[model samples]
Target: MKQFVFLIDTGNETSEHKIHATGMTDALKRVQDLKNHLNDNSNSDLKIKFKGIIYENAF
Candidate 1:
């Protein structure tokens, strides 16, 4: 598995999430799922921005 570090910018603040996945495709899917969940549950005015992704060494 590989580690993917996602940098999420919410306008007000930024958050980091580390995800373990088989590859880039899996990592992207996971990130999309998280964005969808956040969008569905958060206030309408809240905007989610994806700053960047860091592909880490395999573990």
Candidate 2:
């Protein structure tokens, strides 16, 4: 299985501008796409999953 992890920082001074522009929903969608991309080529025959989301000090 492919595990996707997204660490979002609302106030990450050094964060990329795209993060703020795309927001979480769109980002997670990209993650789903990534999982699908990996699943298509992997030989493990496992399911794709999103672990836990840890949020702190969300702006």
Candidate 3:
């Protein structure tokens, strides 16, 4: 496993998610999970998007 940094662009704000996964697909799934959590917990009308994979194998 490796550390992957996913750049999540929420239209109004940007956040970084550092996840441990074996590949890009796994990292992407993590991002989606985060998005779901945010949507379920907030009413801020977030426009969530997967910006890009910023870094891989960070540590």
- Report, for every candidate in turn, its global Cα lDDT versus the true structure: 0.71, 0.43, 0.70
- Top-TM-score structure, candidate number: 1
What local lDDT does model 1 show for residue 25?
Answer: 90
In model 3, residue pairs whose N, Cα or C atoms come closer than 3 Å (at least 3 residues apart or on different chains), thus clashing, are none
Note each model's CA RMSD in angstroms: 3.3, 11.6, 3.4
lDDT of 2 by residue, 1-59 (tens): 22224432223221222222134576567755655675576544434333344344455
TM-score of 2: 0.40
- Write down the worst ten-residue block by lDDT for model 3: 48-57
lDDT by residue (26-53, candidate 1, tens digit) is: 9889988988887787654444444445
Q: Model 2 off-target regions past 4 Å?
A: 1-21, 45-59
TM-score of each: 0.70, 0.40, 0.60
Ranking by lDDT: 1, 3, 2
Off by over 4 Å in 3: 45-59
Choose 2 or 3, whichever is better by lDDT.
3
Query: On residues 1-59, what C-alpha lDDT tens digit does candidate 3 reach at each position?
Result: 76667666656777877777778888778767987898897777655444444454466
Q: How do these models rank on TM-score, best leading?
A: 1, 3, 2
Clash-forming residue pairs, model 1: none
